[model samples]
Target chain A: MKQTPRIASLPPAFGSWRDIRPLVAVVSARYRTLLQYRAAAFAGFATQLFWGAIRLMILAAFFAAATEPQPMNLTEVVAYVWLGQALLGMLPWNVDADFRQQIRDGTVAYDLLRPLDLYSYWYGRTLGFRVAAPTLRGIPMVLFAMVLLPLAGLGDWALIPPASAVAFAGFVGSLVLAAMLATAVTLLAHISLLWTISGVGVDRILTVLVTIFSGLVVPLPLFPDWLQPFLNWQPFRGLADVPYRIYSGNIPPAEIVPELVFILVWTVALVLLGRLILLRGVRRMVVQGG
Target chain B: MPQIEVRGLAKTFRVAERLPGLAGAFRGLFHRRMRDVHALDGIDFDIERGELVGYIGPNGAGKSTTIKILAGILNPTSGTCRVDGLTPWRDRRRHVSRIGVVFGQRTQLWWDLPVIESFDLLRDIYRVPPATYRDNRDRLIALMDLEPLLDVPVRQLSLGQRMRSDLAAALLHGPSLLFLDEPTIGLDAVSKLAIRDFVRELNRDRQVTVLLTTHDMDDIEALCDRVMVIGNGRILADGSVDGLRRRVRNERVLVVDYDSASEAAMLAAEGEGVRLVERDASRVRIAFDPERLPAATLIGKLLAQGTPHDLFIEHPPIEQTVAELYAEHDMRER
Candidate 1:
C-alpha cells in the first residue's frame, strides 16, 4: 500500500482570489441542485400561468364596469398582470426547510466549524436559489405568455418591450436588485428560526405578508388610493411590483431612477441587516447548543 | 506543551420551559420561564501529542459538549480550553482548520451529490491546493478502500459505507488532532473492526492526537491506552483501563463446567470468599475478591472438591466494571 503524505505543515494565507472560490462553489452547487428539480420548476410556472389568467379576467371585468378613467390602460394592465405572473418565482415566500432542519438537528455545528463566514456562505446559496428558480420558471413563463396572448387575438395586451434601450437596461438592473433584496429578506426569515426553533410560524407569516404586500396578488396601482402609498413605501413591493412596473413601462421615464434608487437602498439595508442578524444568531447558537 | 489542554471548562444552557397544552403554551407567551441546564462543569484534562484517549460516559454526561467546545463549534460558559496552543472558540477558523471531527450520527457530505463531488467541494471549502488535495484524497480513498463507492451518491450509501467515507472526508485536510464522537456506532462487527484498525493505524503512523468518545467498551479496550470516564458533567475517573477496573472492584470470576451437576453444587460451597454469583446446572460462576484469595489458591480449593470438566479465571468484563463505577459514583442517572 502507498503511504499517504501528511497535510501541509503551514496553513496557507488565503489570497483574495482563493477566498472567492468557496463562494462561487457554494453558488454553483446550489444552482446545479436546483436544476435537478426541473419538473418542479415547470409545475410552478404552470401554476403561476393559471393564476395569471384568472387575475387578468377579473381585471378585465373591473375595467369594463369602471365609472371613471383608470390609471392604467387595458393593454398596460394585461402586461402588468403577465409580468407579475412571470416574476412570481422571485418572491421570497418559501421557507428553506433544509436550514431549519440543520438548526433543529444540531448538525448546524458543522457549518460553524467551517473556515468561511457563515452569513456569506448562506447568502451565496440563497442568491443561487433565488436566481435559479426565477431563471428556470419566470423567463419561460414570460416567453410562453408573450407568445400565447398574441396568438389568442389579444395582440394589444401582449407583453410590450420597455419604451427605450435605457429603460430596458434599467428594468434588468432593477430585476437583479430585486432578486438580491428578496434573498436577503428570505435569509432573515430562515435565521429567525434560531429563536423560534420551528419554521412553520415564520413560513406562514412571511407567506401572508409577501402575498398581500408584494403586489403579486394585485398590482399596487389597483389598490385604493389610501393604501397605494403605503404599499409603495414598503420593501416587499420592491421585490415584484417595482421591477414588473419598470419592465412593463408602467413607471414613467422620470420616475425610473428614483424607483431604482429606492430598491438599491432597500437591498443594501436588508443585506446589512441580514448579516447582523446572522452574526448574532450564530453567536447565540454557539453559546446555546444548536 | 500538551497537545490539548482543558481546565475548569463549563457550559450552562438557558432553556425555555414551555407548558404542556395549548392554553399553557399561550400563557407562556406572555411570561415564559427559563431554567439553566449545566451540561459541563469544571471539566479538566491534558492530552499529549500522539495519545489515543478514550472518553467514555453515559448519555448526557457532557462528553459531546466537551468535544464541541474543543472542536471550536460551541463556546464554553466558563474556564479555558486550548488545542494545539490555540483557544478553539476564540481562534475558531484557524483552530478548526487544523482539527478534524466526525460525529457518527451525522454526515458532513452533500446528501444528493456523489461522494467524490462532496470530497472535491470540501477541498475547495478548505482551500486546499489542487495537488495537495489530489494526493490526500487518493491516499484516503486507498486507505479506506473507497474507490468503488466514490461515484455513488452519499444518500445511496449504507451506514457502514457512509461512515468509511466520512472518516476519509474528515482526514482529507490532514488534521493533526482528530475527535471521533461515537465513530463506530451502528456498525456491523466487521465494519467496527475495520474502523478500529484504521483509527489505530492512523494514530500510530501519523502521530495524530485522538480523543475518542464512545459507548463501546470493546473499542475502548482495543484502541485506548488512556481512558477518561466522565459522569454527570464531571470527570469520574481518568487512567489506564486496568486502573479504572481496579477502582471499581478487584474481583475475578471463575466459571467451572463440572463433570456432573452434583459436583457444581459441592464446589459452590467450598472456597472461602468465593460466592456463587451465577449458576446454571453443571456450569457455575464463582466470584472472589482477588486480594482476599489468590486465583491459584481458589482453584486449588475448587479442584480438591472435584476434578472439574473445565474451568477458567478472568477479570470481569469492562462493561460491568464501568457500570459499577457509574453506580458507585451516583452517575448512573443517564
Candidate 2:
C-alpha cells in the first residue's frame, strides 16, 4: 500500500496570496455551477420583461394624467424602470438555500471544520450567487429594452443610455460597490440562520425590504416627501437605487463619490457586524441534528 | 504529553419547550418556556498520540458532543480541552488544520459538485501543496476504489460509496489526528470491513491518532486496542476490550442437547457459580464463571445426568456484554 504523506508544516494564518486562493476558487466554482442553469435565467428574463412592460404602461399613464410637475420626467422614469428590470437579479432577497439546508441537517459542521473564516467563505459564495444571475440575464434584458423596443417604434418607453460618459463610468463603479453591499446583506442573512435555523421569516421580510426600499419597484426620487429622507439614508438604496440613479443622472456625477462613500460605510458596518455575530453563533451553535 | 486531553468537559443547551395542541401553540406564541438539557456532564479523559481508541456509547450519550467539541466544531459550556497543545475552540483555525473529522450521517463533500471537483475545492480551501495533493489524491482514489465514482455528483453515489469517498476526503490534508463519529453507521459488511482496515492501517502505519465513536461492537473489537465506554455523559469504564468484559461479565456458557426436555430440566447438577441461562425443548444453556467452574468440569457434571446428549461451551457475544453493561448502569440509576 502507498503511504499517505504528511504535511511538512501548517499554512500561515491569514496573509499572503495563499489566503485569498480559496476565496477565488470557491467563487469561480460556484459561478460556473450556477451559470449552468440557463433555463432559470431565461425564465427570470421572461418574467421581468412582463413586469417591466406593465410598470412602464402605468408610469406613462400617471405622467400623462399629472398636472403637477414630477421629480423625474417621463423619459427618466422609463429609463429607471427598465434599469430595475435589467438588474433585478442583483438584489439580496433570500439566504443561500443550500446553506440553509446544511444548517438544518447539521452538515454545517463540515464547514466549521475547514481552516477558513466562516464569514469570508460564506461571503465568497454569496458574491458568486449575486453575480451569476445578472451575468446571464441582465445583458439580454438591456439589449431588449434599449435596442429592440426602440426598433419596434416604442422609443418613448425604451431604456435610454446613461446620461453622459461620466455617468456611465460612475454607474460602473457604483454597480461593483452594489454587488459587495448586496453580498454583505446576504451573508448576514446566512449567519442569522445560525440563530433562527429556519430562514422563512427572514426571507419574507428581506424580500419586502429589498423590493421596495432598493428602488426596484419605484424610483426613490418619486417617493412622498416624508418617506424620501428615510429611503435616502437607508443601506438598501445602494443595492439597486444607487446604481440606477447614477446611470440615469438622477444622482449626478459630481455627487457620485459621496454616494459611493455611503455604500462603503454601510458595507464595512454590516461586514463587521456579521463577523461578530458569526463568532458568537459558532460558540453557541449547538449542532442540531444527529 | 497526550495528543488529546479533556478535563471537566460539560455542555448545556437551553431548548425551547413549546406547548402541544393548536391552543397551546397559540398561547406559546405569547408565553414561552425554556428548559436546560445537560448534554455533557463533566467528563474527563486523555489519549496518547498514535493510539486508536474506541469511544462507545448509547444514543444521546454525549458521544457526538464530545467529538464535536474536540474537532473544534462546538464550544463546550465549561471545560478545558487541548488537542496537540492547542485549545480547540479558542484556536480553532490552527487546531482544525491539524485534524480531520467525519460524520457518518452527514457528508462533508459538496452535494452538487462531482467528487473530483469537490476534492479540488478542498485542496485550495486547505491550501495544500500541489505535489502533496496530487500524490494523496491518486493514493486515496486507488486505496478507496473511488476512480469510478470520481465524476459522479455526491448525491448520486450509494451510501457505501459515499462513505468511502467521505473518508478519502477527510484524509486529503494528511491530518495526523482523526475524529470519526460512527464512520460505519448504516454500511454493508464489505464497506464496514474496508473502513475498518483502512482506519487500522492509518493509525498503525502512519502513526495517526484516532478517536472513533461507534455503536458497532465489531468495529470496536476489530480496530481498537483500547475501548472507552460512556453512559449518561460519564465515562463508565476505560481499558482494553478484555478488561471491559471483565468489568461487566466474565461468565462462560455450556450448551447441552439432551434426549428429553424433562431430563434437561430435571438434571440439577449441583455446582457453584452455575445457573440456567436459557432452555429449549431439549437443549439447555447453563451459565458459569470459568474462573470458578471450568467449562470441562461443568460439561462433565451435565453429561453424567444425561448420557445420550451433545454438549458445547460458548463465550457470550460482545453485544450481550455491552447491553448488560447499559442495563446494569440504568438499574443503578433507578
Candidate 3:
C-alpha cells in the first residue's frame, strides 16, 4: 500500500511560530463574524446612554448634598462612570452562546478532534468576542460623552481627558491586560457550560458579581469604606475598577505597574482554572443522545 | 504493525440518576443515585492500513463509545489501544492531527461562515501548506460538486450538503485514517449514494483507512470489506457481512402478492425451518432458510398452487439480523 506523506511538515509542538496559526485563525474568524452585527451595537449604545444619564443624575445629586470629602470629585467620577459604560462589553459577564449549543449538540466532543489544545483555542478566540462588540459601541459612546457633551453645554458633566501623557500610556497598556483578564473570565464561564444545563445560573451570578465588584455598576470608590478592601483584593477589579481609576488619575502613574501586575496574576489564574476544568470535562463527557 | 490496534479496551461512565418531580429533585440534590454504565466492556479489534471496516449496533450499543475513545476525545477506563503507534488519549494533539473524524449527527463547520470560508479556516487550523491545501481542496470540491454551495452559509445548507462540506473539512489535512460514526444517518437515497461513492473512492484511491459505524445496511454491504457487529458493549460477531447473515437461522425473506385473498391465506402456513412472518389481504411475507427450503423450491411450490402476481426474495434486513444476533448472544440488558 502506498503511504501519503505526513501533511504536517511543521509539527505544532516543535515549531513555536506554527502554533500561533490556529489561534490567529480562530480569533480572526470570530472577530469577523461578530463585527457584522452593527445594529446590535447601535441598540446597545442607546441603552447604555439612557442608563448613563440616570447614573450621572444620581451621582450629581449625592455629590451636591455630601457633608464630607470624597475620594473622586464629580469630574473624576463622571469619567469613571462613562468609561465603564462604554467598555461594558469588555467585562465578560456573559458566556458565549456557542458553548451551550455545542455542549447540547455534542459538537464540543467533535471539537476535540483538532490538534490545538481546547482551552487555549477558546481563550484566544474570546479575545475577538471580547473586543469587537465593545469597539463598535465604545467609540460612539466615547464620542457622545467626551465631545458631544461639551458642545451641548454639559462640559462639567462630560468625560474628562486623561490626567497626563504618562497616565494615557498606562491606561492604554492596562486596557490590553483588561481585555486579557476579561477573556480569561469569559472562557471560564464558557467551560462551565459543560457542567451546567442552561448556563444561566452561573452566567447571571457572574453578571451581578462583575457589575458590582468591577465597578461597572458603580465606581468602586463610591462603595462604603468597609467594602473597599474586599473589592481591592478580588480579581474582578481588573476588568474596570483598576484601569478606569488609572485613566482618571485616581491611581497615579507610579502605581500602574503594581496594578498591572494584579491584573496579570488574575488572568493567569483564571486561564489555568479554565484549562483544568476543560481537560477534566472532556475526559468524562459521555455526551448523551446522538 | 497495523495502522489501528486495540486490546482489552474498556470505558465506564457513571451517570447520576435524577429522580422525578420537584420534591424528588430537592431530595436527590442531597442524596444522589449513581449508575455505572460499562459502555465499552473489554472489546478489541485491529485494522491494517487501507482497510475499510464497518461497526454496527442498536442505539445504546458501544459503537460510538469505541470511536470516541479511538479518536482521543474520550478516555477509556481500562485496557490499552493505539493508533499509528501512539496511545490516543495520551498523545492526543499529535494523534488527532494525523486522523480525521466526522460525527454524522453534528457538523464541525462554523454555522455562520460560508462553506468556502470554513474550508479556508480549516486550512489555517491544520496549517496545511498552501500548495498542498489548494491541490487537495480543489480535488475534493470537484469530487463532491461543492462549487455551487461554497458561498452559502453552513446554516442554510441541506443535511447532505453540510455532510459533504464536513467530509471535505475532515480530509483537507490529508489524514491517513478516518473515523465516521453514522455518516448516512439522515441522508436521502441520492445523498447516501453520493457519500458512499466519495468514501469508496477515498479509500481506494488515497488508501485512507476508514472505520465507519452506521445503522444503514447498504453502507456496510456496499463499502466495508469486513463488518463488526457490537451488542451490549461486546463484539458479538466480526467477519464478512455474509458471515453475519449466515449466523442468523433464517437467511432470507420472501414476499409474494397474490391476485386473490384465497391465495394469500393458502400460503400462510410454513414448512421445516421456514416461518411465515406477515400477510395482508393479497400479500404474504415469509421467512426461510434458503439452504433448507431453497427460495427456488419454495417459489416452485407456491407457483404450483397458483400463479402469483409478484414475488421477490431478499436477505433479511440488517436490523433483524443484528437483533437476532443480540438474542443469540444473550447479552444483558442495560
Runs in model 2 with CA error above 4 Å? Answer: A1-19, A66-75, A105-110, A150-156, A161-165, A225-228, A286-290, B18-33, B254-288, B293-313, B331-334
Clashes of each: 0, 0, 0
TM-scores of the candidates are: 0.87, 0.87, 0.85
- In CAPRI terms, model 3 is classed as acceptable
The residue-by-residue lDDT of candidate 2 on B1-334, one tens digit each, is: 9999999998877778988899889998898898888878899999999999999888988898899889877778887989999988777789988898888988888877899999999999988999999999999999899999999989899999999999999989899999999999999999999999999988989999999999899999999999998888888889998888877899887888888888877877556899888788888888898889888777777667667468887767778888898998892321
Error of 2 at A228 (Å): 4.1
At residue A180, give the lDDT of candidate 2.
89
Using lDDT as the measure, which candidate wins? 3
Question: Per-residue lDDT tens digits of candidate 1, residues B89-153?
Answer: 87888998889999999998888778998898888888888898999999999988999999998
What is the Å distance of residue A123 in model 2 from its true position? 1.7
Q: Candidate 3 — which residues are off by over 4 angstroms?
A: A1-18, A104-106, A224-227, A277-279, A286-290, B18-26, B249-320, B330-334
Ranking by TM-score: 2, 1, 3
C-alpha RMSD over true interface residues, each candidate: 10.5, 10.0, 8.2
lDDT of 3 by residue, B34-74 (tens): 99988888988989999999998877789988998899877
Q: Write the number of the candidate with greater TM-score, choosing between 1 and 3.
A: 1
Name the 10 consecutive residues with the lowest summed lDDT in model 2 chain B.
B325-334
